[model samples]
Target chain A: MKDNVKLMKGNEAIAMAAIRYGCDGYFGYPITPQSEVLETLEAQMPWETTGMVVLQAESEVASINMVYGGAATGKAVMTSSSSPGVSLMQEGISYLAASELPALIVNVMRGGPGLGTIHPSQSDYFQATKGGGHGDYHLIVLAPSTVQEMADFVSLGFDLAFKYRTPSMILADGVVGQMMEKVVLPEQRPRRTEEEIRRQCPWAVTGKDHGRTKRNIVTSLELDSAVMEKNNERFQRTYREIEKNEVRYEARYTEDADYLVVAFGSIARICMKAIEDARKEGVKVGLIRPITLWPFPYDAIREAAKNVKGILCVEINAGQMIEDVRLAVSDSVPVRHFGRMGGIVPNPNEILDALRRDFIDKPANAKED
Target chain B: MTREEIIRPENKVYSRPRLIDDNYMHYCPGCSHGVVHKLVAEVIEEMGLEEKAIGIAPVGCSVFAYNYIDCDWIEAAHGRAPALATAASRLNPDKVVFTYQGDGDLAAIGSAETIHACTRGENIVIIMINNGIYGMTGGQMSPCTILGAKTATSPYGRRSDLNGFPLKVSNVVALLDGTCYVTRQAVHTVQAVRKAKNALKKAFKNAIEKKGTSFVEVVGTCSSGWKLTPEKSNKWMEENMFVNYPLGDIKDTAAGLEEKTVEVKKS
Candidate 1:
């Protein structure tokens, strides 16, 4: 990836990485912030050179279903959409989850209770980590803060998706999606052959042949309650395994910090700036950036809490992830939330101010003493 | 004559296609799904695409079409089969892909997918079973439900003002230039069954040949759903179904077979 360094928007990086990762199909409907992802793919014309199939679908529903079709054939397929579009794709996403097919989805989030704004906001953290669709299911959620991460996480997301046979999403926000930054784009990997696909994904609907008596049938509808319950249990076990194994996070200035800040996606980048600023002032404030939002780096945070006075959960929303942060710390240390909702990504100075007020300047309680 | 001589291999005219699995269809005894499934199997077996054919089954009466057809099957969510089939056909250009859907699956919730895939000229076959009612959900009215037709949802005989007019999806899609072939046939009668099978064959052949969308709407009878006997339903189809949905080739404008513009001289 370091060989071909290029400055591109986060959306463009995702598109380039998808092609470089040997994605066989890209299906998407244009929406703001992430529309550039589709535009860049079309402009690059991967179909002419790499034979990757790209289609501008009718709607997000159709787009996700298109992803289903490609994924069913054991191909590397993906789709990118913003908030409203991602909402429409929930049904298909749940189906893909139920079928246990590997596919990549990128949600460059915009503000929304309902079409709230086009500006960056991390309001969809809960939706992405917890099942975004009906039924008991979960997607492997990767939150990328930087444009470089946007590019790298594409491959990482796909790898995890295929490894677990579950859908994976890169949950960035409008800021990371719109901003331009240097990224080392990966070299183009060729799409897999039919033989390779069958070998890689034996459960795929890859048409029966080579003395394979059982034709693959992909469906989620099991009428029997007991069977469906067992399927749910299997998914729960997989989630537990993922939690135990795939927890990823990055800690900064936490070696001798008094208070810790928790954030992810674009807000994590902002929190990093605040951590740096507070460190310059001799304020013992650190940051924990959860790369994988679902398996919420709980053990790492618990370890961080062993020294910190408390934790401050920072976000661009009305504190959705604070609950998870509290769960991580087990309420032993004081936990508080600071956020600015409705497209307002608070400044790093404001986060430092909250850190100063919430933990730095707070009087020692009798219980703590 | 001995049993072997009486029923020679040459004299054996009827047999199940190899692709039709031993699992019997869950359709009603008199339902036309069994016949259509056989035709699809016959086409795939005849074309020798058993190794490459992928069928996307819809979410209606024929949702379990995968059980009967021994091919790679994708049970699509509701009416989203067209979108899925489009991706399948486009991504794996060498593979033959098709969608088997019912009237509700094609004309109602998934109308957008069906129309868009057609307009995009996706190289896929859409096998539509328009039985005029939702048989899977216990005979509710579908988008293709006829006027004055009494269904579970429309128990008082559907009125145009109360319920919308029936959707003639094949006829509407035929208007799209993207479609290479569009036909409406029935399977109630022997001759009609043969015609329907021919239509399916052409549709599958179009996908194999990389032609654009091929849509085949087979006006079928749902005797259990229609609250009639199998014979009565077939008879009713002849008298009423054909009146609105005439069984014939609505459009046949594939590129290479366009009326033989270069006439051959009779030598």
Candidate 2:
């Protein structure tokens, strides 16, 4: 381990990162396997050091509104929860989107349909990438696969959130949330002063300066249909700008591969191992891991699909991200899904077997074409 | 007297609060929301907090309160104003933060948010306007709808078994250790309006001093909702609503009253 390196859970990294990044406040409710996030913040006492407020709210619903209030003041505020809790926060999340506020939401996802388990699952991929809440809105979703990423994405998420004045989410699964790994903690940045906040966030509701400035109102409600439609158009424009500029992904060994593995979060790590084993067996395989799930790496996947004969979407859920992969390649290459449902984490060997069975051995895709 | 002389500053006995915007209000005639809004605006102006005041408008007739009050405002989701106010006040301890809520928003859908915010002792002011009926949604039965009162939803007149008793949310919060001040007031008469304004001023001062949650409930009239004229609605509220939801201070730790009886549990 290096000077900056420390072994910690992904959940712990998120708390540590938030403090170092000078987050103004964190309001959350405890839910496993992400309860460690709140516990770590409470133990660290960021309030005494960086003056970051940490509060255990009565419920996820309350915590999200707290974030909304803090965000309206142009403060860096956030909340973390698991599936059921995040589900309870949908209305607030939609309001955040409609208000065009900047905030962070971390979802250490667990098995669900309804409290399926406290174990790892990527079933929330559709919920995160598509709109989890009501209204035509999108969250800047960052999927972290490692403890290092868990620490890094906090500042990055805040940066993008403030840049666009929109909500950002770190969509990590239970595996990444619970597993321990080495992380290089970022340097501490001081929290912004009141004057700095007022200047940086002129649109924020930091109160009118005794008529020196115009009153700022933070709200999502617009009763006029014509005006609301214009607001929706503006949101759509912001989304288009994000999609064009923020698409992010990491591609490995796709240059000579006959098949590609598309995945994200913890499952991407599993897919990478499967690809390594497949390459050793003389069956060329590669991996494409999307870092930003909302502004998904459609172009990168399409570029990689040019060389690959078929693509396999490996997830912890049945087949959520496969639809996106299909939409990216658009029948130019055959795309299939391989996954384990209900909190089960598939081994590398199982993934390789599926890859071989579906692509190499049968080549069922080629015959169908 | 000449028109110019009558309009002189010395001749002026009353003036509207500078914080109140010139836009027309959307409230029904004789609705207490307008009077309450004016009182809030006046209090913020009188306290010299017109610039550093943040108001949380709940989902009800007062949802457009932000338009009338010239200050930084956050229009919160229905009944979630207290939760929003909690963070705003905590983050900006030096600034004034308050929530404007109605009966249905405060006592029904937002009951958990309201109760918990008080229990947490958040340094915020909560202004609850209890009209005994849902004014915005075509006069539906609200949690504060009195026993035997008639509403659209309770057309048969609220029976004890069929409909629950009216919720005295102010009394409920006054019992909580987090509250520094809790009072119920109204604005039906000129004298009543003066008293209600004083209550709001005290509440805002408590919020500025960071003395935990200060709750002020205004038992007011809803003319259209009650299917009565504005003047009759005020009389009805005074006769019926006042008996159940009585006025006067339920708790006032800020005035050193009941300091020994109230055990404060820090949040």
Candidate 3:
């Protein structure tokens, strides 16, 4: 583990993890902050050394489609972009989700109503956690606060995607994408054999075999409402099963802490720092970092409610993940939100102040568990 | 029990290929889609790519092209076949991939995808049929329609000032460095049909060989859109449309190879 440790940015860590984990192709367009991802891979992809293919596409739309195409061949392929670019890819993403193609998509979100700014923002929480595209489907949205989690989550994302035959996303913000941190890489796993992939994704378009008894077709179009309803039900059932098997969360100091901070992605990183600061001042504050935003750590929050008096939901957006936090806590305890929108990242000092003002100062309002 | 005595069904003699199903086409009488379909099927058969090929069918007149083409077909959003084809080809590089598009589908709304696919040199074939009118939408003015050619939108002949000049898709695609073979052919007569077939075969071959992007624009006739009888529409194409949209190879890699070698030598 020590040997695998290195200082790397979030973007580089993602690219390296994808390559080491046998991701055979990457298709992407150049976007700020995330452009380093393409640049790093472009410089290193000496076709001889790595048998993978890297293509700089003309646009985000084309890039995502390319990933769609490569994934159809039962190969692990991925693409990355910022918020506006990710919006362009929604059409393809919806198609991928509908077709049940296993692929990875990373969105280093910046502020956006339409290209609002280039800085960090968690405004895309609604888009990522709920369905971004126009369809009745969901992407397994993973949010990583640390560079190490960014790398580790990608490998896990690919695993879950292939396991369920669905598209998965690593929903990070610009701050997490651009910030540099120390990380310990994991041992490279053996590439899944083609037979294994074929066995898993039996519906993949590997060309027709004359000897096969029946042809396999992959499509999202179901003209019959009843049939489409049944398909949606099946998808929902799978999502429920995923919710059961894949909810991940981390709690720090929640055992005795009076206030709990509910956060994710880059904002969660800042909350950890705030938690540390508040603890030094004798303010009993803890942090709850959500790793999987879709299969949200509801149960974890419910359990924390047993001891924690109040929860402060912090995010880069004005309020998106706060809604989820509120839903999870469900009036069992007082829940408050602190956030900054339009690319403004909340400062650690500001969060510490919010903790002092809302929970520490107002001890009477802090409900006892 | 002799082998010679064993009898096989006569229906198996000329059995339909895997990609082509037994279904009647929805195209109008004397429309060039039948010829185009046969040419594509013939090429697919020749290259033995039927089992591996994936075809993206565009909206407009060719929306139901998937019904006739036997391969795995994906129906794309309006004018988005190129993007869909790009994904399909990139995903299945070993598989033969192509998009069957019409004038409106390729030249108008999908222009961005069409140009980008060629510019990126995506290893795919684009079969664009330019019939100078939108058949599915009841004779709307298409991007490939000639000057002074009146349709439902341009009832008093197309005005260059009011409406833009007709788009030359083959010429535009030829300008892209990624396109290895770009040609414009007509399917008016038997001789022209043979030439168009040859061009189609070359384009598919180029894609199969992984040479680069290949585009073959076929000038077809739409009698229903033209409001002319099938016989008269053939004459109209020969007399009017052919002169404006001439049939010839806009960019031929085989011919350019000599010039490229010379340039390389100089460099």
Best by TM-score: 2
Ranking by TM-score: 2, 1, 3
Residue clash pairs of candidate 1 = none
Query: Which residues of candidate 2, in runs, are more than 4 Å off?
Result: A1-3, A363-369, B255-267
Considering lDDT, which of the candidate structures 1 and 2 is the better prediction for this target?
Answer: 2
- Estimate TM-scores for all models: 0.96, 0.97, 0.89
Docking class of 3: acceptable
Cα deviation at A137, candidate 1, in Å, is 1.0
Candidate 2 lDDT, tens digit per residue, A1-104?
26668999999999999999999999999999899999999999998998899998999999999999999999999999999999999899999999999999
lDDT of 1 by residue, B1-267 (tens): 889897888998889899898995688877999999999999999989888899999998888899899999999999999999998888888888999999999999999999999988888999999999999899999999889999999999888999989999998998886788999999988899999999999998888887789999999999999999999999988888889898898888853434222567899
lDDT of 2 by residue, B1-267 (tens): 789978989889888889898999899889999899889888888888877799999998889998998899998998899988888887887788899999999999999999999989898999999999998889999999999889999998887799879999999998887899999999998899999999898888888788889999999999999999998998888889999999998999956765334558899
* Per-prediction interface RMSD in Å: 0.9, 1.1, 2.7
Give the Å error, residue B98, model 2: 0.5
Error of 3 at A43 (Å): 1.2
lDDT computed for candidate 3: 0.83
Tens-digit lDDT track of model 3 for B60-131: 888877678766666666676777677667656677778899999999988988999988888899999999
- How well does candidate 1 score on lDDT at residue A81? 98
Compose the digit string of candidate 3's lDDT tens values, residues A291-362: 899889988988887778778999888788888888888888888889888788889999988877777778
Q: Highest DockQ among the candidates is held by which one?
A: 2
**What are the runs in model 1 whose C-alpha is more than 4 Å off?**
A1-3, A366-369, B1-11, B255-267
